[model samples]
Target chain A: MPSWPTLRLRRQSAPAAPDKPLATVETQHGQRRLAAVCPRAAAMGLRVDMALAEARAICPELTVVEADPEADRAALAALAAWCERYTPLAAPDPPDGLFLDIAGCAHLFGTEAALAEDLSLRLQRNGLAHRIAVAGTAGAAWALARSATAGAPCTVLPAGAERQALAMLPVALLRLDARMVAGLRRVGLKRIGELARQPRAELSARFGPLPVLRLDQAYGAAEAAIAWPRPPAPWAERLAFAEPIGTPEDLSRALAELARRLCARLEAGQRGGHRFAASFLRVDGQRPAIAIATALPLHDAERIAKLLGEKLDTVAPGFGIDAMVLEAEETAPLRPPQAALADLGKPQDTELAAAIDQLANRLGSARLWRAAPHASHVPERTVRRLPPLAARPAWESDPAVERPIRLLRRPEPIEATALVPDDPPILFRWRGALHRVRAATGPERIAAEWWRRTPQEQRPETDLVRDYYRVEDNNGARFWIFRAGLEGMPRWFLHGLFG
Target chain B: MPAPASLAVLRARLHALQPQAGHGVLPFGDPRVDACLPEGGLALGALHEVGAAGIEAETGAVAAGFIACLLARLPGIKPLFWIAPACDLHAPGLLAYGLDPGRLVLVQTRDDAETLAAMEAVLREGAATAVVAEAGRLGRIASRRLQLACLKRGTTGFVLRRWPHGRTAAVQEATAAVTRWQVAPAPSTAAHREPGPPRWRVELAHARGGIEGAWIMQAGGSSDAAHPLRVVAELADAAPAPAVRPGRAG
Candidate 1:
């Protein structure tokens, strides 16, 4: 196995509480005990698993805060997100640290040494005290970053040199629980080198399989891959300038150039994209991104540039933008546009796409929607609201039946006068208005959705039938009202109005 | 004297502004109705105002139905956009007027401003063949904006005035609309015995570069009928003759 460039950040929780000798205490067995100690508390000889009383006695001025494992986890996750600017593969090293795979990214900062130096300088400016170590293996890097002295804060081990790095670190650095460390200590093993000297079979038999597995991982003899915060995006292009750009004209020019380059690559690959996002990395460490989506697949650089230009006002060029990256996150296979005849007029399809893209960019994609027909028998559920570009079933309308030009969001109850128990209404009073019926017709019954009811040994409680009527008032007003429920004691509601 | 010379120059400029050819008119296919309109038909790239003859729901429904039928009769598969604040329209009633549910796109806006904006956008984009909007309050500036947008693309627009509180005063206000119409449900024909078709008395109150007249029209017929509807007759208001009674002077 060869070496992998891994960066580890250790003691990730202490920077949150600067200027305080903090000791995190937890309630174990109904008694307070120290879970972890910060650097200042550690300088006072406070230790993990020490009783709170003993720690208080040792350092009377110590600040004791209850341990929050969740907060520590969240801080590590945020750090991992920040580290993504350096490498695509960045993951939280659980309760306290982060692991970054920067194998090919070191050259971006000129060299590995420069990368480590830059990281150190940035963390210092951010008020976070970190001990970072770059090693050939994540396990070896983790062990070295935690146990190595302050003078050797940034340790870079050569390829296949994990054995030597693990040999110098303590056995406790192997990520073992307290019982495993105590078992190894009882067996007279104090360092990783001592454990490596024993036969592998004998070591496993004495301390279970964990010690051998941990040693193999740290020695670069086992498979270990860090789980990144998210899988890498399919396509991304980034440009970093020597000097930050502040003017809108320059920004627009740069954006057009990037669009051209990205579209060229997409053309070469025979692909088109519906979603394009450009992230502006400001010098102040604030990332502002603008995303534009088209209703149809498009790869024209000029069109993309125009759409992005419309959103340039939203990107605050605060301090100045030092770098910009463009990504075609959602893409599809390109279909060649049909050749146009001179007398055929402009291609209406492409014109519609351009107009839709412009409107969606301004009004938001949610505001531009189309009603799609569904197979449901329920009137309201028969049509669904969907994005404009979403594929919908062919509209099959029953013209023989009458439908309202507008349907109320919900049916409103109305008082009505009827001749019989199941007959149509003669007159109705709605919204505090009484109307005399001039003519009336109907009793169009729509039964309940019986398929929705399961085979329960019960009555038809889930099924309610409706008897609709079309009536004209003496004032020449028409309405579509319905009687809910069946037979006796039914309620009348105004469902919709007729033209 | 200066205004007349400037008006002549403005007329020349306006003549130059009109698009070439007659590709924008939509004929009603009836001589009585089409002859009363400029270009011998309804013009695209313009805003038209439609309102009920009375404040009753039946009259408003007839007005809306007439526009719906007109939009459906256009020679294209393009969709129709109808923007309104409070659409008390029955979907089935629209079908009775010959509009296909598949070709309909409804936009229920919250206020008159949104309605106007949506109408303008739809017209400017030419995404829909026609945009019909129901508005309670439409200022002059908003109507001008809609007309300009309609001119950008040869899209037709219909502004149906459905004033709240059943007020008809807004119908008489000065508007930028190229045409104004009033629709009311007329008495049905008696000889058919069965419910023949829905009839309406359509009055062309205002028209640009054309004359105004009133017509009696039918909108629908039975399943076996050849045509959906037709213009049955044209109406003319008759002047009353002076009376010479025994006790009164003529």
Candidate 2:
């Protein structure tokens, strides 16, 4: 089995300038105090929780700044995202640190020692003061990273060597509170080795279960799972600019290149993405992203670029964009088109589908719709609206009934006179004109759904029975008119039109 | 001098050498109506306008039914998209005219411009086989754009002119349609009319390379009952007497 090499960053909150004695202070119990101290401040005989006035008295030139934990957390998350270049599994260990599970990636940099050295060199180039420790378990790594001497800022412990490696580290490095560390020191257990040698049940009964759990975790006896801030997409590509690009054309060019690269990766995996999102990282700390969806899964870079181009105006590249990343938000296994000549006729269909996807991408998807049939006798409830690409409704069960071509939005009232109560209208005045009914069809009775109506709704006005008539006027015009209400005085309303 | 028989045969040969007459035409299944068209039938992959012969609700209803019957008779399985200003299309009514409720996609737009835009998009994408759009006043450029889109993807387009109220004349702005037809409701053929097959006075006002003509036709049950649009009669230039009335024997 392969070993799990866990790496942790210590003193992650330290400022960029290590030469100055910089200390971050926060209000503790309404009193201004030092929350954390840099290495220079610590070397200058100042410690954490020291009062600002006392620290200023100790070092006349001490620089004290208010603690901004939010900024520190943001820095840690950005560092974690940067660490993804080395290993796919990188998590932000908050309040100022990062965790990298670099198991199999060590070989890419020659050796584990070399990988740690490379990471140290890169962090140093970025002017970040950090100590990195690699071990078989995260707890051991965390302990060693925090307790390492200033001369050696990087350490790598071989697998199963966590106990020996951590033996010299102090109990405070075990991530315990100040009170717990003071209690452990008072009990004559100053080093991690002394704590580990104590009787387990006694230690649990005295100092509670946390110290014991920490020791077990350090020695690889317990499990530790790191929660990553943002899970890395399987297929993603990034393009970084030395100088930020401010022009829309340049941004488009950069996005096209990134999309092409991502499409290449997707093609290698024989997969297609149904949805893609492009994020533009601006220099002024704004990250704007645009996402587009396709009806058919696609891996072609040009098609993706086209869709993205349509939405380029929506992406605001304020100040300037420094880096752009394209990620496939949703993907599926692609079934390549068959090479047989018999299937050649389907290219037109494919073209049509692509065109539709483009239009849907440009206009919102909700704007494109299909008609769906409903199983209802009500004239208005017989059809439904669906997306354009939905499957066709079943045709075998469609009843052969005579229906009008165009239906009015609502039944418009008209004056009509019939020779008999049951007979069709002989003359009607609709839209202020009298129409002499030259010929007419019978009254097709359509009853309303009584089961849906309540007892209170069974009023004379809510009478829902309709007798539809297909009538033609003297000037050769047809109408689908209906009569509702009572038989004694039926109210006539025009409902549909037949060309 | 050429002999009469030889001259006739020579003319036929010349006509055959020209571009195939019925290459892009969709037959109406009625020879009498097809005979009036330049291509022997309705031209496919082109725009056609349908409107009421008179400014009345009943005439508009007849025109709508005529388009519905044509839509039901369209070949293949491509879905139909109908764009209108409102949700005014009656699905049940269309079903009675032979258009399946399932095959119809209704897109309700806010205005005439949006309706035209949606129709153009549907035609250009070729996502739908046929598109039927209702508009108030379609300009020449807008109709041309729709026509061009249809020609690009071989889509059939139907533009229904829903005349605005209080206007006695139809909205007749010049358009880019291959055929312009006006259909009015005619009396049923059966005496003591028991709701026999529907009849209409169909007038072909515009056809490329063809003279305008008018005819009276009837829709009856054909082999394909799902789309039973047949032209039953061909009226002369002179008006014919009212053949039958509703409650009286002819």
Q: Which numbered prediction scores highest in lDDT against the true structure?
A: 2
DockQ of each: 0.23, 0.34
Q: Which residue pairs come into collision in candidate 1?
A: A403-B91, A403-B92, A404-B90, A404-B91, A404-B92, A405-B90, A405-B91, A406-B89
| Candidate 2 Cα lDDT to native | 0.74
Q: State the lDDT at A279 in candidate 1.
A: 84
lDDT of 2 by residue, B35-111 (tens): 56666767777889887645533235666677877877776566778887656666666655666767766666667
Displacement of the residue A116 alpha carbon in candidate 2, Å: 12
Q: Model 1, B12-61: lDDT tens per residue?
A: 99987885344477787787677677767788768898877554432257
For model 1, chain A alone compared with the true chain A gives a TM-score of 0.76
Give native contacts recovered, as a fraction, per prediction: 0.26, 0.63
The digit string of per-residue lDDT tens for model 2 on A205-311 reads: 99999999889988999887679765768888878787988887998898789889999999999999999999887765466889999888889898898789878
